[model samples]
Target: MASVHWAIQPVLALFVASSVLLTGAVERSPPSFVVDLDKPAYERWNSVIDANPDLGRDAPEIFKILTGNINMSNDTWGILFLMAEKIHKRLPAPFKEELQGMADRAKMPISLITLINLAYDLTAHCTSVVSTDANGTIWHGRNLDYNATTYLEKYTVHVDFKRGGKVAYSGVTFAGFAGMLTAIKPHAFTFSSNERDVGSFLENLLEMMDPNSKFLMVLIREVLEEAKNFREAISKFSLARMPAAIYVILGGLSNNEGVVLTRNRTHVIHEFAINMQSDRWYVLQTNHDPWLGDPWYDNRREAGETAMNRTGRNNITVDSLYDVLSVPKTRNKYTVYSTVMSASHPEAIRTWIRNSTELIPPPPVRASASNVVGRFGTFAAVLIVLSRNL
Candidate 1:
């Protein structure tokens, strides 16, 4: 890519990865669209056309790949969307109008648009960390992973949510998704959603149909727009009846203000925080419950914690924190992007669209007489297959 795209990847790898190999640049992603909440809801995504122009051409294909994992015919899926919509009036005020505008612009169905927006909730494979350095400056960081990383990283953009013509909050997301997965409230706090897949997607879908339920993404948006500090956000988010169980990590402007809230439907079962007294200055959460530890297969939590501890408190900064998160095992092939933020230092909100070679999924394989393989995203697997073909 152009020099403009090559921002922090090399320096980050060199600084953070003492042993792992890294190639290509993690592009400093551009803003796809800006949503002005003060305007009519349907007009909020208007800038999407000019800012992220390819969204119109790519929406259908993006949606198709996202739903590719699910087994259902188009007709059956259409019926399911309608049934869910009938039972649950989910698109409240700005979201429905915003979606309507996006659908009209993209020439896609509103139901499918809404489905993908909410789909971000169901596929919540991600890692989040909140830590304070020796000076007690809290830095919040996260890596969002999804099966559709190939598509998402291409259109990855930073969205600025504006109210009264000012940036109220912002987050890194794809072109068409309207909800918030990772967000920052200026000088208040930074928070992110990690999927707690204790229950199946069907259970979450049933909860979505309850009409009273709210997607965690929407709730995160609400928290960013509503809450002004760490404790307020914690109190409001902890009591929230989220449609599914999830972990919300919060990092605040003040010292020792970082905490991970482990929540179910209506209550926060536990609060894990930065313990300066015990020298546990960082809290990490992946897809699993933090206390039980990440499963042997998904070692993101373990790997991330190791990176954090390795980046000693005296040496922690934005670049160092990004390095901590750039570990190959932690930021794997499925990672779409990495966002680093500090509520205390709101001016330097940084997000990098992860596009390095190791993070890229293998290209689609051509049909061969001996094999009909589809994809081999891992580097070693791709190398092995390439050698066989050669």
Candidate 2:
């Protein structure tokens, strides 16, 4: 694994602390990070794995970064296999074929990819906000607060999936999973999942392997690919028993409304509406489950709602939304990347990534011709790993 060292300047203490609090990160400068994956599934993955052989060596550590201290014992794999066997029959054909192609091209085990996909939602928390700007542009924003570590920083990926007749969707995420933490399917809807800790973490995880269970990520991907509207997306959730507890925020571009569905293993416990009326036009969420109040959960939820109210929906732009998302009172040590999107406008998605520097700036450099190729290769590798996870 590669590492970058940071020097804390006594004088810059204020600046460093402010940056982390304001931006949910400390700096913008990163050392040599691997390429970002973005490609059509068939052509891009093989080149990615070839470029980053280190991924193989780092898999276990990477898994730890995402899943926390959970022991990946033989029993874990056994459960994953059984879960995959059941879920496999439910995935769309095109996606399954593409996933298999990714595994073949990457030369890794398909089960590895399946495990990563199934495990993605295991131990993560996030924030999701939905509101409309003055122009009535529906905005959906999400901040992924994963377990913190430098290794996890460099391996993030962005994927764009286009299946012939279905709406196209894309977003940034980790490799080795087909589910979504954040993504937008233009003209259709935008979606994100915020982890909600409800009961015994380990008990919930073990229950996820039941043959009747539908993993949240896989279910989200299904809706992204097939659902034609926001109503359909919500209906999809209403019909299935989600594998775990989570908050699914789905905003429809066409209808210009967003709903936050709180779910557990059996049914939807509560639902919140994010309607863009003239007066009250915003929605906010954090790691805490409103149903099961936790004072210990960070105060950022209140801070974020206040920030949104201060900015006001009428004044919210992509940059302004980023500003709101960056507020320290609304962030934590593990809060990594922030994404804001125009849910109704297909390609209008913006992502702010954290770097190793104390004073955060924009993403390292612009994509040149060579960098473009590398970006494509990286995207392919990530897709391959996520979809194919050997």
Candidate 3:
């Protein structure tokens, strides 16, 4: 009986050891997708570009500059996939483990994971334009007229939160233009008068964010409440010197509604007509990515036309050039005008103007001198005139 128990004990010990080994060997689930950036895809892309020499030959200098700066590695794609995974909130466990492993290996602050993710995403999208030439030379579209000096001066702060502490990374280059500039000049555009003005504006704007900054808040509130009044003041001051139409244009009056009170009210008609010629005048947001066709473009045009027609200036013919300012900086924070024209046959300015339903009331009819005299006073004067004629 003792020998049999001893034999069973050895078997139990072996079973326990085997269980531990199996547990240790078990692999965590793979990330929804593993970005193997170290693979041959990078080389394939380069090879394709090297085989096509005629494609970017016209812009040799630009191509050289662009290719020199770009990092076309598997790491770039991996980072992009990670960002997309996070944004979609569908990151796989294995991917998460890899990210954790990377952070641990680098001894980086955990909070910085998100910032790194953002950097990766931005870089990936921006560098997508970079391609290789037939001779195996990499080219970047952004290198054309690349001003390295101007690129390095702008900086933005990034904050990361991990493990209940904040990690700050300053002077990080998330954009290619910025990276080029950083490599060139660390502090070239600082201390200028223009910089000072911009700094002051930013300071004031920042102060308004603090609840304790009562004075700043009051000033902001006043400015907001008096915006229309301020516009009117500027308009009146400028109108005193320049022609009414010019003043209206300079004083932030481009639409028919703004010019209705001015002497050259007809100017709005011309401006509207001119704006219609440019394909850019109409745009709208969409649920699908902008790379996909935007369904809202036509809808936005119809809406803008509807709004313009409501202003009641449809009939006026304008010969003079109308001042059509681009969408104001105050309105669009991310206004991007694409270099490529999307539509084949953009709507004509005249057609849009003709479609406007807004009608400016015709000028008041004038009464004849004889009719005025007969209707009102001056009967004695009329008789005197008749007697003198006789």
Candidate 4:
């Protein structure tokens, strides 16, 4: 008991100290790496894995919590890993290679790494906003809320994908996964992807298994790397087919560049854009179609819109935009990070690893059990692992 207490006290201190050191990390930024596009996808993140040996270290616990539709009642991780082996066959090639490299480099199991990557697709949620300030400068802000916020933030990474020694694009991504959840192409465009769960889990599973569909976040990564400008990205994004439905909020370099897309597996259903002349200069999206109201118990959309309007178009500075993101449900306990960026002001594209989870309303059942409960569960799980090793 004394040894266990000794082990836990330092572990707790390490957590607290890490948090203190990363204060305003979004401002200073997380460890940023340049990914070489010329290399095989799996080999690209080798350096990241080496620098952060903790890569895939949390997979066992994260996977236990994941407990996909096929494994909710199962305590054994072997079954989950086997189930994910099949899911692995269907994931895009780039991610397959990347996860392979990460698993090998981190000395973790590839199947467990695959399961961790799949966790986001199985269940994810976020809030994003694109606003055209009174001066007509476009500003994009997003709060990436997820189930395993506590663990996820620890591995956050900002990566710039480069080719021929020139930066092609960048995204603030989690270390193990290769997709771009929140990304930007300096002087070109910026965007964030949100998950859409409009149908049965079975239907979504079928979508994931479809060969013709792309993972939405990877598609974002593709466009950011390939698409030259906002117009090109808009066309490519709308036309690309995905395994499931999604929401994408985009901000371009121009004042007229802000737009929100509601997409199904094959294509976009609706497009909401900034209309400065019409006085609709800002659009806020929180895991719902713009035409439909938010689900009961979810006030992120209402709270975000209220904050945006209160801040108003004339005052859409990064600080104000962050304040809007900080408003109640918009920035909840589940949020891993908050990102604020503008393609026009490429240098100002900033991301912060967030720790506040205040005023989270009751969350529906999700792949990410509510962080309120899971945060402690995650810490306890880690402590147990450390104690055994010690």
Candidate closest to the true structure, highest TM-score: 1
Measured over all alpha carbons after superposition, the RMSD of each candidate to the real structure, in angstroms, is: 9.0, 11.5, 33.7, 10.9
Candidate 3 lDDT by residue in tens digits, 1-390: 001122323333333234334434221111111123243322212322233233232222222122223322343334433433442233233234433443333343222332343222112111001111223221111101111111211111111111223211111121111111010001111000000011121123222223333221122212222334324423332232211121111112222111111112112222211122342222222111223332453232232233223222322111100101011110111111101100111110110001001111123234455555543343334323333332
Say what the RMSD of model 2 is: 11.5
Model 2 poorest 10 in a row by lDDT: 1-10
- Which ranges in model 4 have alpha carbons more than 4 Å from their true place? 1-28, 64-80, 86-93, 200-202, 357-390
Scored against the true structure, residue 126 in model 2 reaches a CA lDDT of 81
Question: In terms of TM-score, how similar is model 3 to the real structure?
Answer: 0.16
Q: Summarize candidate 4's per-residue lDDT along 1-390 as a digit string, tens digits.
A: 001122323433333344435443232357899899999887899877877776556766655544332224233354445555666665667777787788888888777777677666656689999998877788999989877666677778889889999878888887777677888888889988887867643356446655677766567777986889989989999998877788878899767788998888888899999877788889889888888878888989998898777667876777677667766578776888888888888777777777643233334445434533555354345434433332
Instruction: Estimate the overall C-alpha local distance difference test score of candidate 2.
Output: 0.62
Give the alpha-carbon lDDT of every model.
0.71, 0.62, 0.21, 0.72
Give the TM-score (vs. native) of candidate 1.
0.84
Candidate 1: regions farther than 4 A off: 1-26, 53-68, 84-89, 356-390
> lDDT value for candidate 4?
0.72
* Candidate 1: residue 238 Cα off by (Å): 1.0
The 10-residue segment with the lowest total lDDT in model 4? 1-10
Error of 4 at 80 (Å): 4.6
lDDT of 4 at 297: 85
